[model samples]
Target chain A: MARKTTQTRKAVVTIAAWLIGIVIFFPILWTILMSFKSEGDAIKAPLAMLSSPWTLESYGEVQARSNYALHFWNSVVLSLGSTLLALLIAIPAAWAMAFVPGKRTKDLLMWMLSTKMMPAVGVLVPMYLMFRDLGLLDSRIGLVGVLTLINLPIVIWMLYTYFKEIPGEILEASRMDGASLRSEILYVLTPMAVPGIASTMLLNIILAWNEAFWTLQLTTSKAAPLTQFIASYSSPEGLFYAKLSAASTMAIAPILILGWFSQKQLVRGLTFGAVK
Target chain B: MATEHSRTAARLMVSPAVILLFLWMIVPLGMTIYFSFLRYNLLNPGMETFAGFDNYYYFLTNAAFWDALINTVTLVVGVLVITVFGGIALALLLDQPFWGQGIVRVLVIAPFFVMPTVSALVWKNMFMNPVNGVFAHIAKSLGLQPFDFLSQAPLASIILIVAWSWLPFATLILLTALQSLDREQQEAAEMDGASVLARFWYLTVPHLTRSITVVVLIQTIFLLSVFAEILVTTNGGPGTASTNIPYLVYAQSLLNFDVGGGSAGGIVAVILANIVAFFLMRMIGKNLDA
Candidate 1:
């Protein structure tokens, strides 16, 4: 009898969870649904909008109406470019701090995390002026550089956490086994830390891809990512729900997939391992 | 394990990241402080001169400054309240033995993945538009007037969108923390005839306190600089209703070219954010030691 009651309770809990989940997921689901509807039908009453005959006209219109491909390419380049650069700089530092004992290592990690706390606007003036004077404005290189700098602290901290987890005995054992220092690190440490590095890379890419502040302020036309392309919809023809949905869906689709994979890493990275 | 050669090598490996981050933080910040003391405007180049405290005076005295300050606080606090509470509720629900738990988790975290600009645009035009939006369609079908969400309640609408994006984050973190709770202890408490409320209040709430603090502080730091949602939605309008410190700085320097005023504003914002960061750094620093 008790087992039956527990099973019934589980069923009740499942129904409630699904209902809330669907409501929360409705907006994204609706956006996807709206993308498949006719423009006129998208703005119709909610039930009708959902039940209406679906079509792919808006997706084609989205491509035809704007420079969607260019913005998409910019997003891909900036996100991947910045993430790779940050990892290159962070890996060595994280390795040294993680494996090596130093007096200022903790202080250094804390200080780096503090830098992440500094509000972006606090230096927007100088950064903007520097970019303008250096003729780096509206260039992909400029955006990539800025994204790398902003995300560097996060990259370092995430890596440091992951690196710290690795037992020093492993490295010590390898060294005692007559492995050279270079090969021990290259062959042993690198292989062990690959999961950490990959997850860090994934989270960083999501951050850079969705970054709106620098991307919006720094770029005008030549290097504006999908953020800008989507914002442009606001002033001109944002009212076209079908095309707008199509653009938004496309713009967010790649990152959404990327973000899902990094959910566990995200909690760890963003919280700086506080909860974990 | 201890060798002079490796110690030197470690330092060499770490120098590049440290130096670059130091320069990135200090250089622009140093310039901003210096510019805050000057009467500089990008509109009229080469007319810069020392004007100590004058920019600060102007920025402090400006009515818009106060509005932006209040709006910034409101946005941060508003989003925190919604997301934190909503997060707890959702996390609790998801923690139950539910069918399709994996799919539900994926669905719940979806909004966080949507780019800020895309989410902002979608909500503004498609969900919140007065006449042609989904909300309007619902209202009209229910025999009611379509409410103009942005114009009527600009800050609230932006807060809603921001909360939606951040809710997943709060849920994910709290759920992570929740998952670590001792199942045996909870089962024991239940066997002792403790009511659900008592167990939840004494056991679950205490367990989540650290994660909740983490969520609140991290969200505050990001929430203080909420720019894109405001930019794309109300543009800090119906007149400064949704303007936060970041948007104000962006406007003063980039839009209006008031370098002095903007830098002063930026300095003020830095001071405000540091107050929160001080506590947060300490919290995470404690975790690092553990």
Candidate 2:
């Protein structure tokens, strides 16, 4: 009888959790749903809105109205480009700090993290002026450089955390086996930290992809990513409800899919030290 | 043995990124400091002189500074409270064995992956619009009045969107922490005839305290810099209702083009952000070391 009651209680909690989770997720789901509806049907009452016959008209219209492919490409280049650059730079820095102990290692890491805390807007003027003066504005290379720098600390921190989990004895063994420093890290440490690195890559991509401030302010036309694509739907005249939702849905779809596939790694990377 | 040559190589490998960031930090900061002491504006080009703390004095005594300070604090605190509490509740619920658990977890985390601008736009248009939004439809169906979420309570609405976006982050962290708790302790507590509330308060909450702190610290860092949401939704209006320090600085520089005043405001923002960062860095540093 007690076991049965416990089972029932568990069932109730599970049901409630599912209900709340679905409710929380409804907005995103609803936007995707609305993206399939015609403009008139999108603003219809909720009851009819959900049950309305879906169409691809909004997607077609959104494509016709905006350069979806360009935005998609810019997002791809900026996010992947910045993430790759950051990892290349961060791996070495993290390797030094993680494997090679020095007095200022912790202080260096702290300083990098502190740099992240400085509000980006605080330096917007200088960055904008610098970019303009240097003719780097609205360029993919410029955004890549800035994005990589901003996310460098996070990338290093994550890689450093993953590197710490590795036993020093393993590296000691590799070194004793005549592995050079380059091969030691490239062959041994890199392979071992794949999961951590993969998750960090995924997380950094999401961050850079979703990054709105620099991307919005720095780029006007040439290199504006999907964040700009979504923002374009907003105007002083009025909000474009249906088209905006469509843009938002399009902007987030790829990352949402990516996040779903990498949930395990993300969860683990996030909980790296919380349990300990 | 790790040789001196290897250490030098390591430093060389990291030098490009380090030097870039160093310049990135110094150049802007030096400029802001310089501009803070000078009389400069975009409109009054080439007519400049060192004003010696005049900009600082003006900014400090201004009411906009205090308003932005309050809004920034309130937004951060409000979002933290909601996410932390809401996250704990959801995390506990998710910890229970459930059918389609993976699917539910994905759904819970989906909002976090949405771009802030997109999420804000989603909330602004489809969810919170007074006439045609889903919330209005529901209110009307239930025989209630429609509400203008953005206009009536702009700051609160923005806070809700932010809290919603961050809920999954907190929940995932807390859930991971919760799962790490020893099952034996919970069983023992239950076998001792402790009520559910006592078991939760004593066992689960204690286990989650560290995760809570981590979540609070990380989220505080991100939340303190919240800009995209406010920019997308209300543009920091209904008369500065949703304006945070970042928006305030943006307005001062980009809109007003009062370079000296704006740079001084920028320094003020830096000081404000560091106050939180100092403590957060300490905790994060401790966590990293451990």
Candidate 3:
């Protein structure tokens, strides 16, 4: 009797969990499904829409009408560009903080994290004016610069936590073996740090990709990423649901896959190592 | 580890990041404070003059500011409440042995990866629209009136959308924390004949408190400045009904070209965020010691 009850309970829980999961995920799933339908079919009621013959007309329309490739390339460049730049600046700093103990190292790390707290809106006016004055407005270089600064603290923090996990003894052992400082760092630490650096890069790219505020405010035509591209559809055009879905599905698909891979790092990075 | 040579190199390596961050934080912030004191307008340039605290005075006294303030708090608190509570329930459910758990977890977390613009547009167009929306279709099928969500309840609708995006985040963190919970203690409690609710209240809740606090504080920092969703969806209203502080400042300066007034609003937003940041920083700092 007891065994039967436990199996039945598990079955019930499984069904309930799957039901809730499907409901929660329905929006994204529906969007993906709708992306394949014709404009006329997409506007129909849910079941009818699903039953309609799937087509790639919307995807082709989105690209042909909007130059979707340009925006897609822009997103790729901005996210990758910013993440790489931030990594270049953050690696040595994170390395130093992780290995080198100082009287105020903790305070310094905390202070850097606090800078991340400074709301972006608080600096919007000055940034806009400065960007305007410097002729950097709506430029990829300018967007990259802003994205780097906004995300630098997170990059450094994530790198710091990851680098901290690397054993210091390896470096010490390398030094004791008469390896030069350069070789010790290049050979001994670099290999171990690569995984952490890669994960940090992944998380930062995801952040920069989805960064909406600065991208929207700064970019108009030239440097607009996918976020801006999708926002253009906000004003209702007649029966463009399929096209919008196609664009959105394209925009989110890459990052969703990337995000799933980086889920563990995300918790630690976002929390600033608080929860993990 | 603290050798003098290494210490010097560390400082050298660290200074570039520190100097850049200092300039990044200070320069724009300084300009904002300066601009707040002047009657600056982009449209009518060269007529700028110091206006004392008149800008601040007007911004504070404005009816729109209060509405934005209230909406900001409502959006933040509303999303936090939904995400945290819903996250806990989802986490607890997922923690149990279930079929295809990994795939289910991925599905639940998919929303967090959707860019804010995409999510907002998807929710607005595909799900929440009065006509041709899934909700409208369902309502019609049930012989009920199709409710226009964004206009009828602009702020609340935005909150729901924002919460949907963030629910995955809260659930992910809470699940991570929950998985770390000592199974031995749970088993021991079960052996002691503690009811499921009793064990949850005593053991599970206490373990989750820190993660929950982290979720709340971090979410508050992000939620306090929700912009993209509002921008894409309601544009801050049917009539300023959904505007939050960030959107308010954006409108003040960017839209109206009222730099002085907008800077004042920006400063108020900074002050508000700082209050939350103070608590958040203290919490994380405590964790650093631990």
Q: DockQ: which is higher, 1 or 2?
A: 1
Q: Tens-digit lDDT track for model 1 on B131-227?
A: 7788898888889999999999999999999999999999999999899999999999999999999999999999999999999999999998899
Task: Please identify model 3 stretches exceeding 4 Å from their true place.
Answer: none
Candidate 2 per-residue C-alpha lDDT over B1-290 given as tens digits, one digit per residue, 9 for 90 to 100 = 56798678777866776787788788888888888788988788799899999999998888888888899999999999999999998998899887778889999999989998888888888889899988999899999999999999999999999999999998888888888899999899999999999999999888888789888877887888899898888889988888998898888888898888888888898888888878777776776663
The DockQ-derived docking category for candidate 3 is high
Off by over 4 Å in 2: A175-186, A236-238, A267-276
TM-score of chain B of each: 0.99, 0.95, 0.99
Q: Go through the candidates in order and give each one's C-alpha lDDT.
A: 0.91, 0.85, 0.94
TM-score of predicted structure 1, chain A: 0.97
| Candidate 2 local lDDT, A166-199, one digit each (tens) | 9999988987999996898789987898987888
TM-score for predicted model 3 compared with the true structure: 0.98
Clashing pairs in 2: none
Docking class of 2: medium
- Model 1 has a DockQ score of 0.82
Best-performing candidate as measured by lDDT: 3
